[model samples]
Target: MTRLPASLLPEGLTAAVEEASGARVVAVRPRGGGGASRDGAELDLAWPDGRTASAYMNYDVHRAGAGDDASFLREAAVLRALSGPLALAGVRVAPYYASVPDQRALVCGLVAGCDRFGAITDPVQRDALAADFMAQLAALHRIDIAKQPIEGMGPIESADVFARRRIAGLRAGNSGRAWDPLIHLALDWLEANIPADMPPPAIVHGDAGPGNFLFEGDRVTALLDWELVHYGDPMADLAMLCLRMLFQGFVPLPQAFAAYEAAGGHSVDRARLRFWRLLFQTAFARRSRYDDPDAPPPPNLGMNLVYSTIHRRVLSQALAEAAGVALPPVAMPDAAPGAHDRSFAVALDDIRDTIVPRLSDQQAAVKAKGLARLIKWWRAIERYQPGFHAAERLEISAALRRDFPDHGAAWSAFCQAVSDGGIETEAAIILCNAHAAREAALLADSMGGLAETRLAPLD
Candidate 1:
């Protein structure tokens, strides 16, 4: 029997499970080492019939007192509703339940165990695994929201609303900071430029990634974690999956993209995916800036760079898609930026004197000052503009939008030069100091795992 601190287990959770399943609870053990393990215990149940059961016990952090119990019950209701339907497809989920009236705790049954990413190397295993994942994704999307029983969770009906809400959250985080003007501009454009009508709403697994899944030899045995699940566009799930996979540097793009397309995924609007990709990049960049320095590198780093690189590639691809004209690959560095220099200083100087000075006085003065200083030293150009080689990465990205028609062709052409160089570079170095890093990256074999793909960083 595995013993635990009484406070962590709460009161009667053990008895509740025993009563619900009619299993004799002989021992409770803790399971760890997975991506979704929270600050709680994993219970292992031993019965007289020589069988065993396991459950996940997690502490709720968003509510108070009995409110936590209510939250778990709500999730449980969703699980119950999805259970029968999912079982038909060879899928099952641990029953999500809450023990006691405390608003800060939850206890859920843990389903059959399986291997993690240890088995993703084999192709047959990979395809079967991808198929199973898609089936679960389809199952989630097929849920009838109207009949579901979660209360506080709102209906996600419109892509416009989703975009707006996301933008709003980003703006709120910006506050009166110096980056507001550029941030605000992007947010406004996204809000006004939403697709005419997105594919109808479906329940989405917001954080669909390899890390959150348990695979038994390429077969996804379980899709773990549901905190971010909600009713929304099916594309949202696809985007999340792509973003997660690409960020982790798992494999080739053609393979990943094709796998997704083969899995009954038909919605592939370039503009729609591009929008989410850009939004995901911008949001993640800001988040990285605010995260704890000691924490693991943000998953968004590679993605941010990929978006910027693609922005440039898109210009060429757009032309190719429309005219069958294959443009030269730009010589863009697949690396981060470098330290302060004349070009960077010049860009910052422009933002401070030209851009910041023209902003509305309604903004906070202190934020303006800080932003001015930050802008002066903003050697972060990978996400903003990734098409330029290290030699001029900062200048091109900073000027790409601002300079517009004047530098458009020249900028794009420059990116083509870099893209053709065929090299891998560090994301941070490319943004901070691309000029020096470009040559080295071109000679290097891997550029942030982008390979021969025309990749870039997102905004």
Candidate 2:
């Protein structure tokens, strides 16, 4: 668990706990690796009558804008609506206590007996756990969105609208940047082949996957991370599940789909599921901007870069699948000569030997180690990136058969051409795959283990 500095804790947290539970907060510890959008902490409180209780606090630091509280409220509302139904189905969700809208913070009862499901070692137990999770997901999808309405779920007209809105949102977020041809090609394909028939919008857990839930033994104690909840096609959640399996080794896709259908969810629509999987992967690839000047710096820059690389690779694969083409093999770049700068090596040694041991907070120490690893990666790739990029740009220019001011301009023109139907689908697929492969190779050289594992394409 990560520990937060006293100054980082919200000022009103203690007072809020006192008011809500009539208890005084005795301790507050930050939970490491909080979700993508929020910071979490466990608050230990002592009641006035002498009893003790624990509450979990989640503060929206990234998703909340300057004066808008809508994001926080939206999640709170979803939790409120599904609390009873989920509890009844033996799918536990944290009870909503109170919201500090001003700070964009929410307080809920701290759930116990739940941890990451990946820790299970026994094969039989792991399979049972996977089934249990599928059953819980089915129950969630079976929720009557009309009867138990959640405020601020936004418009839920159809799956196409939802998919388009998401694509539009991603485009809007990155407007004025160099266009990504793969995204455009994928979008064009999606628009041309929108599924005509889809199940009515169900309550979709926008990010349902392995790490998002909590479990103990073979049973899931609680489903966590409801921040992205919204109403959309149920397959959206299923796509996310498959995506999770693609990145993280979890249950097989066929088994998971079987379990879900057997537990009362809609039958798997292969075409729609494929479309959604591509869309989700595209959205992730497009939206990940580690160097965004407008946003705050990420807490862990190395991990951010790691995820960006993974998303880019996945996005390329998804696009190729959509285009019904196979990605060309990625050639490994020649290794760079030994590093002459001893400073990097010295710093890494200091971090591992001197700094990490001194740090009391395990999370901070882990982050420090991550920084060291990033430095090591820099040592490995610093000498090669310039040459690699030049070669890549030359290759891209050759593929496009045109000269442009720079790589960005060339890419934008290529994507625009593809979107305009000037480029053949197969040609676009090959070019995009080459681009994504080169980028992934650079990242893999910098950070190990990213390019080594190849998951079989989802059937």
- TM-scores of the candidates are 0.54, 0.87
Model 2: lDDT of residue 194? 72
Cα miss at 219, model 1 (Å)? 2.3
Assess the local accuracy of residue 148 in candidate 2 as a C-alpha lDDT between 0 and 100.
59
Poorly placed runs, candidate 2 (over 4 Å): 1-6, 10-24, 35-37, 46-51, 64-71, 84-86, 151-156, 338-341, 403-425, 445-447, 454-459
Write down the worst ten-residue block by lDDT for model 2: 62-71
Model 1 stretches with alpha carbons more than 4 Å out:
7-40, 45-52, 58-77, 84-91, 99-106, 113-115, 144-153, 176-189, 247-265, 288-459
Writing each residue's lDDT as its tens digit, candidate 2 over 1-459 gives 433335547576557556755667677776544443455667776776887777788775554221136545666777766665445645567877666665566777777665555566788987888888888888888877666566655555666677777777656554555356777767667767778888888877777878877777888877777766667788888888877665456777788888889989888888888888777777666634545676665556666666656776777777776677876675546755556548778988899899999987645775786687678667656665655656666666776787777766776777677767877788777877777766666567445655655544445
The top-ranked prediction according to TM-score is 2
